[model samples]
Target: MIEIVEKGVTNLELSKHLIKRLNYTQWKRINRFEFAQIF
Candidate 1:
C-alpha cells in the first residue's frame, strides 16, 4: 500500500538521522579523549 511505503521511507529517514547523531557523538568523545591525553 501507499501508506506502508510512506511509513517505510519515514522510518528510513529517522534511522539515518539517528545514526548520524550517534556517529557525531562518538567522534566527539574520541577527539576529547585524545586531546586530554595530549595535554
Candidate 2:
C-alpha cells in the first residue's frame, strides 16, 4: 500500500527526469514551432 505509492512516485520522478534529459531538444523545438504557429 504505502510502498506501492512510494514506488509509483519514484517511477514518475524517474520518467520525468528521463524525458527532460532525452527530449529536451525535441521539446524545445516543438515549443518553438508552437509559438511560431500562434504568433
In the order shown, the candidates' Cα RMSDs to the true structure are 13.1, 9.7
Superposed by TM-score, candidate 1 places the C-alpha of residue 30 at a distance from the truth, in angstroms, of 20
Model 2 is weakest, by summed lDDT over 10 consecutive residues, at 30-39
RMSD of 1: 13.1
Q: lDDT for model 1, please.
A: 0.53
Model 2 earns a TM-score of 0.34
lDDT tens per residue, model 1, 1-39: 355446665644544554576777664665545544542
Clashes per prediction? 0, 0
Query: What does candidate 2 score in Cα RMSD to the true structure?
Result: 9.7
How does residue 9 of candidate 1 score in lDDT? Answer: 57
